[model samples]
Every structure is written in structure tokens, then in C-alpha cells.
Target: MNNNVKASINAVIVSAVFGAVQVANAAFIEDSKLTLGMRNFYYDNDNREGGADQREWAQSFKLDYSSGFTEGFIGFGVDMQSLVGIHLDGGKGYHPDSNTFTPSDSDGSATQEWSSFGATAKARISQTEFRVGNTLTPSLPILIATDSRLQPQTFGGAMFTSKEIDNLMITGGQLERAKGRASTNSTGLSVPGGTEESNHFRFAGADWKVTKDLMLQFYYANLEDFYTQHFFGLIHIQPLGERQSFKTDLRYFKSSSDGKNGEPGYRFNNNGGYAKNPGEVDNTTAIAMFTYTFQSHSLMVGHQRVSDDGSLVWLSQANVVNGSGRNEGEGGISFYSFTDAMIGNFARAGENTTFGQYTYDFADAGISGLKASISYLRGEDIKAVSGSGPDLHEVETDLRIDYVVPEGPLKGFGTTLRHGVYRGGGTSIDDQDQTRLIFNYTYSFF
Candidate 1:
């Protein structure tokens, strides 16, 4: 049988097996949770600097099932997710050039429908848990999964998390491959400008709560043949008054080239910015932020700086498929940084970004489930790889509003609207405007 046919049969078998096991084991049935989710997504991006516009609309569904561990010193359980996406709008003129929303067909057209299924088997013992299979492993400072499109990305991997030590949490994992949000195919890992593929991504991290209001974290990651990275973070919160508080956050990352990074298949693109040593990775980045929260209002300000050697390090596969050009399908990425904005990420060699945000929650005004926020970011002093040029600069502004139905039949329904404007100077940077409208609802069947 074909792979798709086999996958379908396996899904059916898994559903039946889980259903039977639930009925056989009272713990499994009693603790299991099943949820069905629906999402209506509309996206539009206008490149003011001259490029084809990207626009698309789609409807998606997700079926998630998670069972509790059975009784024993080493209990076992299972988790499954089935995802489906259907094209709702966007014809030839509005098809995506970045392939950010929909997968491309053999004729370079959007597919009518796509689906994916994944399952993870887990075991728990003495406050630690082990999970294996297709998993959405928790997001880490080193590898943040992309979930901006119709279906969240999933990776084929195994991970272990432990909270056995008081006031501390530890995590470690090995991931082999990833399925993008828009495509049903799973692909090996690689960075931008890379032609070779790597199936191994290893990482370990720990978070220690030093005090009631202070926490410290350290993490290390190695992407085979790409690079190795170390991250450090600190967060502290202090009570100012009955309804006021102060918060501080600091983050740092140090990265260096790994085996084969400068080889033919593992080269770095330098991403328009200058790399002190082309094709090799070497960079340091730091960010600090302070926030004040009073009642329903919050104000935050932060600054980030990247070392002069290379662009900040993160997993990006923008050029891995279809030979490092535009119109390739299934490209999206995410990172754990304050400068990771909706329209752009202000991370480049010698770049400095200053940003701030203001937010208000309507709960204090008797409007529960309603909130709004606005943010602005300015980046400058970006170094060019050519070693001779004026410094580049950019600015981005974003506005967001979120609302969830508080009661009635649509009590659980939610709506989110976001708009972003970006203007910059550089070969890689572009002036653009983007908007997203999303409606989502989740129903439980348990």
C-alpha cells in the first residue's frame, strides 16, 4: 500500500486501540481528555517595497487526545493529534511567494487540502517523564516550533523532562525530523543557505527557581553539522503594591560553528548581513527588559544587541528546499527573543534594537475576556557582510486586539486581529504591511 494509505489505516487502528484500552483500563478512561478545535485564518501581506503580495484564507481542524498515566511505579500513556486544513480562499493572483500559509503543488498552485497525524507514547516515574514518537516537544530557547500557520509544526523525536528536584526543572531531547505547518511531508533539519540535511538535533536545559520571585535558566543545544549554542536567562518579579508589580528579564546567547558548518552542504547564508567569517557560525546576543504592571495596565521596554561577528543563531530552513530561491513551499521559523516581532526579527550582525509596548486588560473595566496591546521596535547599526557600506536601519510597529466570548453558545469562541507595519533599508529587509484575522473555538468530548 502507499504511504498515505498506510498512514490512514494506522490512524484508524490507533483510534480503535486507544478506545479499547480506555474501556479496559478505568484510569485511562477517567483521566483521558479529548478536544476538537476549529480555526478560521485569513492572512495578507503587502510588500510596499515591490514584490508580489501574499494572501490566503483557510479553515483547519485539530483532534487532540491525551490519556493519563496508568497505575504503577513507571506509568505509561499516549497522546495523539490529527490535523486537517482546507483552502477557503485566495486564487492565483494572491498565492503566496513565501509559502508561509499553504503548500505548493507540482504546478506551483496551492493544494485544495492537506492532512497530518501524529502520536506520542509517554512514560512517567518519580516526577520524571519520557516521551517518544511524533511530538510537539515544549518550546526551548534554542528551538522554538513554528505554529503561526494552519497546523502547528511537529517533530519526530524523544524527550525527557524531570521535576524531581525541588525548585528545579530539567529537560533533554533528541529530534530527528520536522513536519511544517502547511505541508504533510516531514523533512530533515538544516539552516538557511544549507544544501545538506541533518537528522540529529540534541539539547538539554534546566530552570532553577532560586527564590519566590527569582528564576535562572541555562540551556545548551547542538544541531549536527550546523552549530552549537548556549543560552542563559534570568527573570525576577517584585510586588510594588496591592495591584502593582515590577518585572525584569535578561537573556544571553553564545553560539559557534560545529562540524561541517563551512562545508558545501552546511554553509550559512549570512542572511544579507556580514559574517566576520563566511559560512561559519560565530555570534553573541543579549537582551534586557523591564516591565511595570499596575492594575490592568502594563508597560514594557527592552533593548537587544547582536555581536559584530555574525547574525543571531536560530533554526531557519528558508533556503534548504528547492535550491535556495523564492516560491519554495513550507518555510517558517520562530525563536525565543524579545525582538522576534510579527513582521520581522531584529537579529543581525552588529544590530541593536530598542523596543517597547503598552497593554491594557478590559477586565478591570468590567469587560472580561477583552484585551489590547501595541508595540514599536527600532533597529540600527546593522553590519553588512561586504565590509564596506553605511549602517542599515529598520522600524516596525504592531497593534493587536483579542476577545473571547464570555457566555452563551459561543462562550468559548475567540477572535484575534493583528496588524504590523515594517520599513527598513538593506538588501534583505523590506517595507511591508501585514494583517491577520483569526477565529477559533475548542470543544471537548470527554
Candidate 2:
């Protein structure tokens, strides 16, 4: 075993022993979970220019224990998580240039696999809780948790959540570093490379419910020297019929250079627009998506517009939009970077895309855990749009299948297959048929 492996095991053992002691001393063990899974991908990058097929395996474990108030006004608790990954296939040639999903070996070849385990101390009062250590933070308009791979991305930070007010939720946090999806190594926030400092990412947000079917959200984040983002969102769910519902998601984001807008202590729109100041880019984006569901069939369509001089803040929890996840080409059409990034950065100045998708659940047909969907998006005036110039159009489609064991030790076992096709203008060095095959049997031990 290497030093990294040794350290991971040691950490898990230490947390286990510590939890055991707490249990022996009468602490309540509230929750515990374990999941082992694998994801295999038959990927083609740069439109068949490069292809790598491999099966990646990951194992995850989590345990939580909360104590009753000791001083009546104060409460305490502990949370622990252990994550490990193993390389089933794909060598260095298969790995991407960025270090978001997996790690690189010292020999330049693919390392067998890596693991990371972490624990956090918790404190609570009335309806507010504070936690310190490493965990999963899926902040929209900024950092998002990616679970399309065998493992999920994690973060090391201190977070505070409060529910003192009625019908409103407030969240705030300060993150120091981010742990990649497949490796134990943690990194500071950056656009893609390790060229920036670690203490650059910070965020805060609030969500309020206006009515039973209406909700609103606001968020702010700073990526240090890179950029700062502000987001606003609205969601409404309405029942159309006995078994039909319509959901509307409207989101807007304004982004600009922060701390260093080409100068220290100066942050604004200095890039002037996309590709103009390729050295430093910024912009604002808005999206309004509407989905209607009836029985097991659903249809969704939306229009997204990226204004000049601001960057689109992709998110997960609430702000960032979905549907763009199953693009086929590495850059041509789709944008599914959350789980497995095929479109690393899908942004261009003054770009606008009209998107539509259709989905069906096989459960209505008496099949469970089986779903299928197809989507298409056409973008215009991307990268360089001069009032009425050339337009870029992209089309993408996907087919997926999922199956899980219903009972026994393999109860949580399941698999997923995703295939896509992307095409359009200014593909940015990416085009071709791409397929990712992920099959994993999850085992839950509580």
C-alpha cells in the first residue's frame, strides 16, 4: 500500500474507534450508510480523434451521530465519511488534462486508484448548525457536486445553516479546498488549471418560499481572482390535472471579474466580451425552463441567453440549469460536466440557445428504475456575435437504461448506460459520437 492509501485507512480506523468510544459512552448513532459502485465509459474525445474505454470503481461510507443537548442551550454531534476508488481500466492516455475527476500517477501512467476519508465536529442550537471539516457542498452558480462518475466531489470548509425564520432558509459557508470526484487530493478553486490560489472561492445564499407553489432564491459567490457571481431564481409547481403537473424554473446570473479585473483590487467587466479579452472573460446569463408532466411522460423546453461581458454561473442545488448534461461530443453539443464532463466549458459571449427535451419513465409501463430521454439545443451568435452575424447551432440526443436488484445484499445494486450525439457551429475542437457505459452494483451496510 502507498502512503496515501495508508493514510486513508488510518483515518477511517481512527474515526471508527472514536465513534465506537462515543457509542460506548452512550452517544446515539443516528445514521450510517455504505455504497460501492463502478462506472465504465467508452469515451471518444475530440470527435473520435481520441477514445478511451475503462471501468472505474468507487466505494463510499458515511456515519453520523448526534448528542442531546448537554448544557440545555447547546448541542453537539459528529459526522464521518470514507471514500475510496480503484482503477479498473484506462491508463494515462485515457485521463484528461484537467485534475477534476481522477489523479495522475508519478510515472505518468494511470495509478491503480486513490482513497480519502474525513470527519467533522458539529455544533447545533435551536435550528442552526455549524460544521467544520470535509464534506459534499453542491453550491449552484459556483461549485457543484458531480456524481456521474464512480465517485462524488467533496469539499473542506465550514458551513452554517439556519431556519430561525419561517418559510425561509439561509445558508452561508467558507470553503478552503475541493476534493476531486475520483481522487483524495483536494485543490483550491480555479477555472481549470492549478494556476490560482486556494483561498479564492467563497459563497452565501438565501431561499424563500412565497406560497405553497412559488419559491424564490438569491446567491452570491466569489472565485477569488477569477470572478464573482450573483444569482436569482424562481420556481413554481402547479397541478394541471389529476395526474399531471407543470413545473417552471427561471434563473438569472450576473458575473464579473473580482479582486483582479486585470488589476488587483479592481473587479468589473474588463474583458469587454467573449474572445475579445480572451485573457479575462466575464458575462451574465438567464434561463427560463418549463416542464409539463403527465403520467410517466414529460416534456420540457427552455431558452437560455448569455449576454456579452458576463459569465454563466452553472450550478446544481438551485441556480444552475439541468437538461444540458447529456451532450454527445466533448465540446460540440452537450454539456454534462457535472457527473462526467464531456463539455468542459460550454460558454461563448452573446450566445443564445433554444433547448427542448422529452422524457418517459418505464415505471408507468410496469418497469421500475428504467428511464429514457432525448434532447436538442441550437445556439446562435456565440463567441463573436455582431448584431446580426453568423449563428452556431448544436443538436444532441441521449438514451439511457437503469436496473437495480430489488432485494438481498445486492439490493442497492444498479447500472446506467448513457449515449449522446452533439453537433453545431464553433465546436471548439470537439466533435464526434460519444458513449459512456456505467455499470455498478451498490451494497448498503448500515
Candidate 3:
């Protein structure tokens, strides 16, 4: 975290601690909530090629507490989160040197366990709220926190949201550091293949609900010394019948190099694809998706296109080393793209991808809490590293099923099964089949 943010957080904490004792009231104590969430995750990967496979099983627990605002014109509250991960199984050979699944020990084996704690201080006035902490998980167009593993990624920073204007919502923030899903340490932010860290990330965005069925969004983000990005999006829904609807979603992004982008310690890998200026950031991407739903069945189809200049860019710290000169176990990230698949993200330069998904809900068929989905994506014309020769191609197929107990003793218990197959030619990625089984439950204390 940055010095300014640390100072602000410390002041907020001191104020909140002393003020609560003096003005503890009904709204603050009565409306508080607490919950404990448990997850058991099993991951298995079968490398079709002659590569090492990864298999691991782990258990995670998360405790969350949120207190309501104190009764007044200017209200104050706080939120706390604690996460613990236990490495149930993952032997020496199965645990890779990378920190994609579990933290590694000094001997390159899985660590026994890891844990972290964070707190957020918040204040509200009218329809605007401000927050600062290390536990912010933002899911916006420019940034998305990764939560596909044992724990969710978090950022250390400050943010604000305002709904003061009718039909409009505004959000903005600045982040300085991030805590990876598998590691207990926080590190400076950077892109893939960037060894030097950039401590400043700033963004602002707004969403406008123009009508009951239409919405528009715009956002701008910049990672200091890395890249700057702008996003535009549109979403619309048309009701065809009482039980039928059609949805349209469109998105576009334009990114370019920022200060010191192509320098030695700040080079971008372009997602391991060809870049026009080698380590520079330059890219434009567009996507359009349509979904039609009828009763319990829904189908979605989308197409995405990437410019020939470079691959898409987003915030990442996977390649940044820690003080001990070892990998920081921060190898995963989530982006705001439909091509972010189970095993591969088809955002290579000059790549054109088409994808489709089919989903079914069993509620109408007497199984109230069952849902299944299958999706397929194929990308062609991927630029080779040499920027010459034959183009590369890749494909991925994923299948997922989820079920929850509806009315039994384990009413809130849920299970999910997911499988993915990925195949590629002329790329660094290996052909593999991956499967994941997850069990989840949450208990609330009101």
C-alpha cells in the first residue's frame, strides 16, 4: 500500500474506534451482519502433451462482518474480511513452481496453509459513499478481481460510488497494491512479464440506465508507466413474450502505451503473442453478444475481434518477484472479456474468435436447484511470434453443472462440477483437459 492510503486508513480507524464507543446506537448494532463461508475445491489437469500435470485439493474459509451505518446525516460503518486456506493435498511433483493453485514451500512443494485479514472503513452522506481498505474486490469494465481459486484477489486502495443523479451511477478508485489469491503477501501491481512494479492504478466509470430495458456504460483506466485504456459498452433487453426475452450486449476497448511502457523493466509480453513494437502496448478489441431465452432454456452467441497491433492488456502481477527473489504466487487474473475461458484467454494479436453457449435450468422440469451449461470457443489467425509464417489456432470447450439442496437439512449447500478441454497449435500453451469439483456452504449470524 502507498503511504497516503496508509495514513488515511489509520485516521479512519482511529476515528471509527473512538466514535463507536461514544455513539453506539440501534442502527449500528441492530443491523449488523456476520457470515462464514466454506469451500472445498479439487482441481485436476491432464496434460495431453509431454508436460507436467497439476492436481490439488484444498479447503478455504472466509469470515465476513459488516456493520450498518450509524444513525445520522453523515453515517459511518466498517467491514472486515478474514480468509484461510489449507492445503489438503498436493504433493511435491504435482505442485508446480508457479503459484497458480497453491503457495509453494522452499523446496518447491505446496505450503501447509496461508491466511490473510483486511478491513474497510466506509462513510456515507446522502446517496454517495466512500471506502478505503485492502479488501476491495471490484468487478468493473476496466478491472475484475480473480476469484476462481481457493480465495479471491483483493486490492489495497480507496474507492467511491455515487447515485446522486437519477438513473445514473458513478464509481472511481485508485489502487496501489494487490494481494494474490494463493499468497499471504501483498505486492505492487504490474502486467504480465513486467519485473518492475507500478504502484499507481486509477480508474473512473459511470453507468446510465436510459430506460427500463436499456443501459450504457463508459470507463477509463490507467496503470501508471504501463498502459491507458478506455471502454464503451451497451446492453439492451427486449421482451418478446411473457416467457421469452432477447438480450444484446456490445463492448469495445482501446489501449495504448503509457510512460516507460517499452523500457527494460516495464516491458509487456502481449499475452505471449506478437506485438507490433515488441514490448509496447497497443490494441483495440470489440465484442458483440446476443442471448435468447425461452422458459428454462437459453442460448448465447458472441464474436470478438482483436487488432493486429497487439493483444489485449489488463492489470497483472504474475511475473513480479518478491523480496526473496521468488515468485510471489500471483499468477491469476480476471478480465472483462467473454474470451476469458477456463484454460485460455483468446486475446492474441490478429485473433478473431467466435463463441457460443447453451444453458438449461431444471426448475421447470421439477428439479428446482439444478443448472447446466456448455460453451465452446474457437480462435483463428493468431499472429505468430515471428510475425511471419503460418497463423496459429486454438479452441476450448467447457461444461459445467451446479446444484443446491432446496429444502433439506443442507438447504444452502451447493456443489459445482466443471470440465474443460483446450487444444492449440503453434503456441506456448499445452493441450490439456481440466476438471474442478467444488463444494460450498455459508452460515449467517444475524
Best by lDDT: 3
Which residue ranges in model 2 land beyond 4 Å of their true spot? 1-27, 30-46, 49-72, 91-101, 139-141, 263-273, 313-345, 385-391, 406-409
**After superposition, which runs of candidate 1 have C-alpha atoms over 4 Å from their true positions?**
1-24, 318-329
Count: clashes, candidate 1: 1
The worst-scoring run of ten residues by lDDT in candidate 1 lies at: 321-330
Candidates' TM-scores?
Answer: 0.92, 0.77, 0.94
- Model 1 over residues 1-446: C-alpha lDDT tens digits? 99999999999999988886665487766899999999999999998978888888999999999998886577889999998999888867788555678877665667789888899999999899999988565688888887877778788889999999999999999888877777777777777777677888899999999999999999999999999999999999999999999999999999999999988889987666789888889999999999999999999999999999998878755344554343334477788987889888888889999999999999989999999999999999998668778988889999999999999989989999999999988748679999999999999999
Candidate 3, 194-240: lDDT as tens digits: 87888899999999999999999999999999999999999999999
In candidate 2, how many clashes are counted?
A: 10
By TM-score, highest first, what's the ranking?
Answer: 3, 1, 2
* Regions of model 3 farther than 4 Å from truth: 1-24, 323-325
Residue 355, model 3, lDDT: 98
Kindly give the number of clashing pairs for every candidate: 1, 10, 0
